[model samples]
Target: MWTGNFWKQAAERAVKTFAQASLALLTGDGMGVLDVNWGDVASVGALAAIASLLTSIVTSTVGEPNDPSAVRRTNP
Candidate 1:
């Protein structure tokens, strides 16, 4: 079952990754750091969101088998 927790976890991961990436870039640039483009950040966020959406959709649609027989039928 695709619950609220699943979505929340995905979103949290995306945000955390984005923040870490941005921070790394900023620190790497040193004192002469150039402006961080808003568009670039948006793109990264968008990609992460898309990935999470796709994963949720796929898992929700193709759920686990209900019984042991069902699993065996598919596997064997």
Candidate 2:
């Protein structure tokens, strides 16, 4: 169930996450950022799955609304 606003929000979150990841990569020392255990790996995997799902939904329903009334427009 993807709507315009949901797509926008998911895109925003993805962009922010990428930015933060880029900064972390640049600022962290050699081993500090590279360090990852099982829990961290699982968490990242879950996040990736969720992001993938959101992206798929957004792509599949580019213009449709999950709920039209929830979205505000100026042309109405």
By lDDT, the best candidate is 1
TM-score between candidate 2 and the true structure: 0.40
Model 1 misplaced regions, further than 4 Å: 31-34, 41-76
TM-score of 1: 0.47
Q: What TM-score, over all chains together, does every model reach?
A: 0.47, 0.40
Q: In model 2, which residue pairs have backbone atoms overlapping below 3 Å?
A: none
Alpha carbon lDDT of each predicted model: 0.54, 0.52
**Residue lDDT tens for model 1, 1-76:** 3456656755665576667665665566563335766677567656665665566555543444321111233465
**Candidate 1: pairs in clash:** none
Backbone clash total, candidate 2: 0
